[model samples]
Target: MSIKVIVADDQEIARTGLRMILDAQEGIEVIGEAGDGGRAVELAQRLRPDVCLFDIRMPRVDGIQATRSLAGPGVADPIAVVVITTFDLDEYVYAALQAGARGFLLKDAGPALLSQAVRAAAGGDALIAPSITARLLSAFAGAGRSAPPAQPVEALTGREEQILAAVARGRTNSEIAEEFHISLSTVKSHIASLMTKLGVRNRVEIAMWAYETNRVRT
Candidate 1:
């Protein structure tokens, strides 16, 4: 099935460009477009697209607020959102993530990454731009804050720790399997164990915990 997407940007040109790029991809479809955040939120709530591509700055409401409305921590049924911004500053990025945005992409990140991010978000995965991830993670780490430590680490065997570490480094499951000379199923098993122990919902949260707890540094 094609991944349904809502494009929300104040700029007509940007919406057009994104639509063109995404429409060319194999399994992505642009379902709707909104010129402002209020409309975006309304359309998103009504359309229930698989993923929402939102611009940070918009009139009436802003992308951040729209994101929170659709995907915030308290929302019972959160839709996946990918925030697009012209800047990669710590505040904006952090706010978007806290608003439950599944991905953050610079406005100039190009079509390839934009498509990948949308698909990843649709798949219930998260993808931060590589150029932004390290910097953002470092900043979050250096702030001396940590996610609540998980008791599950004690249950993780050494091999599980190794797998988790690779995941923390942003390695995909296939890549982790290759690195450890294990089968893909083994990688999945390790991930499942880690998730069960740590109470994380997805790989991105796992990676976030690794950084927050000082277990991994970029």
Candidate 2:
């Protein structure tokens, strides 16, 4: 089945480019396009695409707000959102992540990465642009808030701890599986267990928790 996607960007060219790239992929489809955030939300609710590709800046509404409405903490049924933006600022990345975006990508992140990100989001995984991943996550981890003395993780086994550390380092599930000489399904099982143990919604949140809890070596 094709992964249905909605492309929302104020720029016609950007939307067109994204549609072209996504549509050319075998297992992905560009189901809709919205020139503004308001319409993006409306279309998202109506069409219920597998993933929403949103640009940060838009007229009438903005991508972050749209993301919040569709996937924020308060949402009852959150849709996966992949924020696509021209900027790579940490603030933008942080805000989008806070708004519950499943993935983040710069406009020039290329067709391969863009497609990979969409697939990742649709598959209940998350990806952040590498250029901003470590810096933004680390900054968020160390940004002025007092770290908790330690996060209680007696539930996690040694293998789960290793997987969590790899996730915090931005390693993909496949990479983690290869690194640990485990199957991909085993990596996913460990991640699922880690999330349950750590009380995180997604891999991004798990990474944040690892950093904030001082679980990852800086």
Which has the greatest TM-score?
A: 2
Q: How many pairs of residues collide in each model? A: 0, 0
Q: Estimated TM-score per prediction?
A: 0.82, 0.89
Give the true-structure RMSD of model 1: 2.9
Q: Return the top candidate by lDDT.
A: 2
Once fitted onto the true fold, the runs of candidate 2 whose alpha carbons sit more than 4 angstroms away are 142-150, 153-155
* TM-score for candidate 1: 0.82
* lDDT at residue 77 of model 2 (Cα atoms): 89
Error in Å for residue 216 of model 1: 1.8
- The residue-by-residue lDDT of candidate 1 on 64-114, one tens digit each, is 899999988779999999999887774666666666787788989998889
